[model samples]
Target: MAGGITEMGEPYSPYVGLVYMFNLIVGTGALTMPKAFATAGWAVSLALICILAFMSYMTTTFVIEAMAAANAQLRWKRREQEAVKDSDSSDYSDDEVIVRGRSEPLEARPILSVQRGGSSPDQFDIVERVEMGQMASLFFNKVGVNMFYICLIVYLYGDLAIYAAAVPMSLMEVACGNHSCSAGSVKYNDTDLCWGSVKRKDAYRVFLTIFTLLLGPFTFFNAQKTKYLQILTSVMRWIAFSMMIILALIRIGKGEGQGRPPAASFSGIPNLFGVCVYSFMCQHSLPSLVTPISDKRRVGRLVLADYALILAFYSLLSFTAIFCFAGGDLRDMYTLTFTDSCHALDAAPLRYFLGLFPVFTISTNFPIIAVTLRNNWKSLFHRDGGTYPWVVDRVAFPLITLVPPVVVAFCTHNLESLVGITGAYAGTGIQYIVPASLVLLSRRHLEPALGRGAVNKHRSPFRHTFWVGFVLAWATFCLMFVTANIVLTETKPKN
Candidate 1:
């Protein structure tokens, strides 16, 4: 549940692997993209999205390669222990046990890759259940592992916060939003009364309370979406995305697109950068996706195709949205824009369906993510074979996982900055810096064992040392840029 080995569900085929990756990569982040694209300009958004997709794909391959390397090292250690016992060369049992107890030596290599006594066909298998967090413990020093966990925990908290705010925000809008198909009515604000003296913000807090009561308990235990539920959510996701795109296209084709987005907007680039980063994020879950492939040979190629499809889908969705509605008219939750009785859509029932899309989809997701965060917290604090007491396990973790995000939602349901900051800082670390570091360190560890010429079947296309450095450098620059932008925005006087 820590984005590690997904043992809760049954194994699936590579075809399912492709679909699962598509679903994982295309998430709530896409909902925020139309507004970001509208802000930054279509051309700028297109180029950055493409480049970031390529960058993400490259890092994905890096992680797979590292997974394979990790498998090889594990295999090598087992083989070494077997040899020591079989040969009876010396009374070195004490030494062997010590070495075996430690994490596999960095330079350990599979016997097959060593070109000697190849007894196992699965020597270089990339499908092993080496989760990202486990890999960090194996390869990274204590500080690195702690830092990785810190970044991941922070990212998951941000995730829960986004979900907490989103579902309630959607509910607040659908319940209190104007539904009379009134033309040219200004959008509702939190200051508006949801009831007699009950402000929209209070309504949001009400829904947030309901959300917590319904879903928060799942955080106390292990929770996984059953196979049927996954199928249902996937179907709902497709319907929501496709409906938005098709409706927008219909409006534009009828010669009513109101958007005249600028060709470029420098001021908008920072947020757009963060949005694209968030949208393309799937690296944290790569092990769970790549580990179950029925056929490992073409995993890289299949991921490339998936990314291409996702990029095209995002472009189509956002382009149609920006053109169908004026940029200034777009909603942070893109579905809300279509939910009102506006010029773009006026069918009452369809409006309710669209307005409630986030409420349904995000509701399904909130538990799974909260459990994931809870598990990550456990993983961070866990010691060797040590378990938490019942009270700590059931009470403390769930409360810690559930409370802060709900607090944030109660304070404000605005998600633009929440999404942007999460993506720019924690998402960047998980997606860009972590993968680059893993592959680089894995390669260095393997050089002595596999020899410089040994070929890794799962090697990244951008396998050169130069590319690794480039990825790290680019990630650093982006982090700095985001930080500076945030600082300036905070300090700048209101105009």
Candidate 2:
């Protein structure tokens, strides 16, 4: 019974199961997928689906190996410490005969039984020492710890910025049709309402400000505890998933063509696919998944399950969005698609249900951004404590996470641009580059342990190397695209 309870505490429960599902859907797919599909089109979107799924699986495998290495190192260090302690207390029995007397004869009695008083104390010392040295020289140095930290920072920043924009956008959509706000100016009912009158830009600014100032702090404080943090993260994940689902469905049913601007170039398909890939880019959270599953076999199974679910979700959403909005001027992506179909006066209970997902997504993502900033600040200063107290940390964390996003909201406040920037840079790095690097590095050093036909049974050396190069090249190209797109499409003049 104790063992059963212990197992429950070790991250194998219904809650974790739901949390993983929610994380995959909301963390990557729900938040950024719409934008990817909007830019990349269905074909590229399909390619992204395959790539992201493969990357996710590879990342999971490497993470398991890294965790196993870390655990082994820790065990080795503890054993060494024990050995050193015993060595310090070493003593020898004074009365023990160095050798039996010659008169006793060769086999007559216990000969030369020089008692060390207790055990040799250094019996396992050599084993412990060797293991510790091997761990430090091999595992710790080679793993992409630094790269993960950098990628996490970038990803979280993008997430916070997008959410900061999205929350106000959602609310503005809600407030425009509310009866009390409308007053007696023009008793506009649901049927009579149009998208023109909504103060979308203003609402977006308000949302951005609130997220930066208010939600940022709240999330920061809550994230201190792992349990609550996980729960909050899980809730946000589901919210993001629901948002993507709703947005995709709305785009499908509405059939595009809502008087929004047309695509500036013939790159919508690429952009859309990028967004789809972004939706499944949950590499930052992969470590959390691996930490829970102890058994190597079980880890493989869980990762496979995660990939299957992600593939199914991405495929369905991409297909529906493309078929529904085909040739209908892919301008403003699905934002216009959503706004056109659901008037301010129309009580979209479905949207409200979906709205919960984005709310959690935006809220949680903001703090993660803040935390990343804090971490970077600490690293630069070589500080031992948290970065909460440092002025540079405070300024950088909030400013990077919030200010540009709020300003963007106040200006153009276009969801497509927000999502595009996020996918192009942050998504590319987090989802593609970092994972590929980790896999390659891990395979290089721990080849025998993580190699095919080995104890762990990972991918072949050639296949692993190919993926590493492939993902890095793809990510680099996306980075270039992001730079070009931003240059070409500067925010429209602020009112």
Candidate 3:
């Protein structure tokens, strides 16, 4: 019964867990996807997204299997500690000796057949949130764990940089560009004047500075979003997304659509691959999301349902966008596309709301992400039973987390490139490579204690050893292709 409650202080339901996973997977990446879809072309984009969705679902199951294994391992260790205590006590008797018998090194013990038919409590019920970091420690060597943390940290930095650039870019556009429907046809450059003398780029920096000063300090202290605030943001996200989709459909229906995209574009595949990978990410946070579910028996179905719904939503959004607007007109941030004075939307108030939406939503997330990164930094270097100095603990870790992303944001406001690089490299590790490694290693770690036949009710459908090798192999291919694409793009002669 205690396992029914989540760390968020709410009683768990399968439906609630579904909502959390949905929200986690569909964030900033979804906003950037329409532009990538347009560039990549609609036919290829649809097929590729479906494939990515299935791959992502497979990895999701892998993470859930790893979580159950981690839980079982934790329970096994606690039993061992209790046995040692009982053996050391002077009043230990028959009952205590029976308990001590279970403490024999796992290799010498008989194979404990899987529990079933209501004979005993299952040892693998997920009751505790064993974070990916803790799972890494349990299953990986020192080098592996360090590599995991480094990949995670780099991904977080990319996330922070994208947020930093997006907010200011939105502000600069709203402040400098004409909002009247008459000037919607015009496009402005960074060199254009915001007021009289101030350039658009300069205005962007001013807003970025203000944003950093206002929200950056929260990183030094622990910060988390309250439940109500999360609910409010989720509501805003749905409203904004719905408004864009409806407007695009209305324009297409009116026979005013201007889009004429190609059927396929080979050059666009690498960026689209990164965007899809980023959009489907939830593996790293599955422990926090899945452990609290009251009924995990149907969790595999819940994940399937969520992914189906999300894939449909993405298809609808991207299809409407590419059919409604010309490829060149689509902005990297899809919300900004709605803000333009184009025929799709003309209401000043609604346009402004859509344009500034990222500012409202991403600001709330930046502090939470900053704190997460800071904690990961501390975890990477932490020593058993050793304490950090006050300045090192309170000041230094947060500074390292806060500075790098902000500096990257300051240099370029090109969000597409940022998201692409982040998702392609570090995101690949977190989503594909890390989950595969975790499940593989966790199974080996638990086999001696639980025995090979012990059932993990939450084991992945992709249970074959071949699937694990396949995921790692796919991750390697993606990284190499993306890196080569980047190099080729940079070296190609400019026209």
Best by TM-score: 3
Please count the clashing residue pairs in each candidate, in the order shown. 0, 21, 0
Q: Model 2 TM-score?
A: 0.66
**Worst lDDT 10-window in candidate 3:** 1-10
TM-score of each: 0.92, 0.66, 0.93
lDDT of each: 0.82, 0.49, 0.85
- Candidate 1's C-alpha lDDT? 0.82
List candidate 1 stretches off by more than 4 Å: 1-13, 85-122, 182-186
Q: Which stretches of candidate 3 lie over 4 Å from their true place?
A: 1-9, 90-121
lDDT of 3 by residue, 343-375 (tens): 667888898989888999999999988889898
In candidate 2, what residue range of length 10 has the lowest lDDT sum? 1-10
**Residue 150 CA error for candidate 2 (Å)?**
3.4
Q: Best to worst by lDDT, what's the order?
A: 3, 1, 2
Better of 2 and 3 by TM-score: 3
